[model samples]
Target: MNYPFEKVADGAEETKLIAEEFAEELNGGDLVLFHGNLGSGKTFFVRSVCSALGIDGVTSPTFSLVNEYHGEKKVFHIDLYRIEKADEFENIGLYDYLSDEDAVKFVEWAELFPEQLKDYDFLITIEYIDDNKRKIKIERK
Candidate 1:
């Protein structure tokens, strides 16, 4: 509910709650960057937010690179996990997705191309605390 929000989720339910609450603050044209290690729930958090936005069947775009969805709002889900070079960004038409002013864009592994992303609405970091617990932090900029 606030910028620089921080919480330690005891399990998946709590994390989903946090994602739903975070989704409330989102709007069209917003860009959200997710930072977390492998198996740290980044995709799950994105899925939760999309679910709160009236979208279903959300899944990771890791292999596909980008997945677009339409619900209450247009959503662009991108995963740069397998991208090896900055040039690959352009090759994947990532610029086109980023230029969509009427969509909410969520980027996973955004930390991999920091220089390519200069403007973002929210930056979220999820750190695994255990098999079931995670520390989630969100910052608005």
Candidate 2:
């Protein structure tokens, strides 16, 4: 479906539906780069993906930079808010995870490494409108 993004309605349930649809089509080795401002529903969508994958207790990796979850497959969710060096990420072995047969990845604040984006399978941008509405666009590189 070309990683098509759909506008999400207000509230968490609607967001879950969107994420579930995305998860239904994705598999291991797929990397999703997320671009969105704070409170733009980035983490919410990630959490919903986790839920769809049968993962429990999904939490933001705001401090840890990366969170690993084991559901249908391993999910590596990385947040680059604290990263000052994009090269340092390579040293952290993020690429290894993405290449792993049992792992999938989702990255937030990925704009820090524009050059590295070509490795991602899809790109996503989320913009907050009013109240709880969000405009999301997903594009293939």
Which portions of model 2 show Cα errors greater than 4 Å?
1-3
**Residue clash pairs of candidate 1:** none
lDDT string for model 1 (1-141, tens) is: 877999999999999999999889998999999999999999999999999999999988989899999999999999999999999878889999998999999999999999998899999999999999999999999
Worst 10 residues of 2 by lDDT: 1-10
Candidate 2, residues 109-141: lDDT per residue as tens digits? 888778866787878788888767888777776
Indicate which candidate wins on lDDT: 1
TM-score of 1: 0.98
Q: Following a full C-alpha superposition, what root-mean-square deviation does model 1 have from the true structure?
A: 0.6
lDDT of candidate model 1 versus the reference: 0.95
- State in Å the error of residue 93, model 2: 2.5
Query: What are the RMSD figures for all models against the true structure?
Result: 0.6, 1.7
Candidate lDDT scores, in order, read: 0.95, 0.81
C-alpha RMSD (angstroms) for model 2:
1.7
